[model samples]
Target: MTDDTAVQARRREIASEHLLFKLIEYVEQRHPGLLDFLEGSLDHLGDPAHDETKDDEAVRQIARQMITGARAEIAE
Candidate 1:
């Protein structure tokens, strides 16, 4: 959560511009380092959401990472 209401609203506005940012924010809020998975997946594959040429496996990998991260979070 941002300290200033304006800043937070602005952030939400920016995040709404892309699915990637929205996903990043959602995962970061609950499972910090899991973004490493998204970064790694993107390094290997194109942005499937925006690129019609790419498959959705990268997104699936991120979802898998999220579930794993969520489990780890719950364990802690």
Candidate 2:
């Protein structure tokens, strides 16, 4: 891919993650009971839904590891 395409892709990735965090925040606010609900859901879930578009394997691996760690922490 061209440098421009790569940059745009990264921007999109960052935006997606930001949106996710914001949604989590919104859920927590709207339902204070969701602290446990969030943790429980994270524990039940595995990695991100898709790993195919992850042309950048390094970023994909990092995301997987982070998600795994978060899930483990939640379980504890």
Candidate 3:
């Protein structure tokens, strides 16, 4: 891909992630403990694809942990 293409792709990725976190915040505000429930439900899905998406999966794992950490901080 061209440098411009890669930059645009990354911008879209960041925007998508921002939208996701905003949605998560909306759900948590509307449903209270529901985000925690959803996070717990995703535990079974943490399996590695063991392929090219491993890096993406790793980043997602970090995002998941970040959400958990943020919740923990809110609790404190």
Q: List TM-score per model, in order.
A: 0.34, 0.44, 0.60
Candidate 1, residue 41: Cα displacement in angstroms equals 19
**lDDT, model 2:** 0.58
Taking every candidate in turn, the Cα RMSD to the unseen true structure, in Å, is 10.9, 7.1, 3.8
Better of 1 and 2 by TM-score: 2
lDDT ranking, best first: 3, 1, 2
The runs of at least 3 residues in candidate 1 whose Cα sits more than 4 Å from the true structure, single-residue gaps closed, are: 1-53
Candidate 2 all-Cα RMSD:
7.1
**Candidate whose lDDT is highest:** 3
Residue ranges of candidate 3 with Cα displaced over 4 Å? 46-60, 69-76
Among residues 3 or more apart in sequence or in different chains, the pairs in candidate 3 whose N, CA or C atoms overlap within 3 Å are: none
Write down the lDDT of every candidate, Cα atoms only: 0.62, 0.58, 0.70
Q: Give per-residue lDDT, candidate 1, residue 13.
A: 64
Worst 10 contiguous positions by lDDT, candidate 2? 40-49
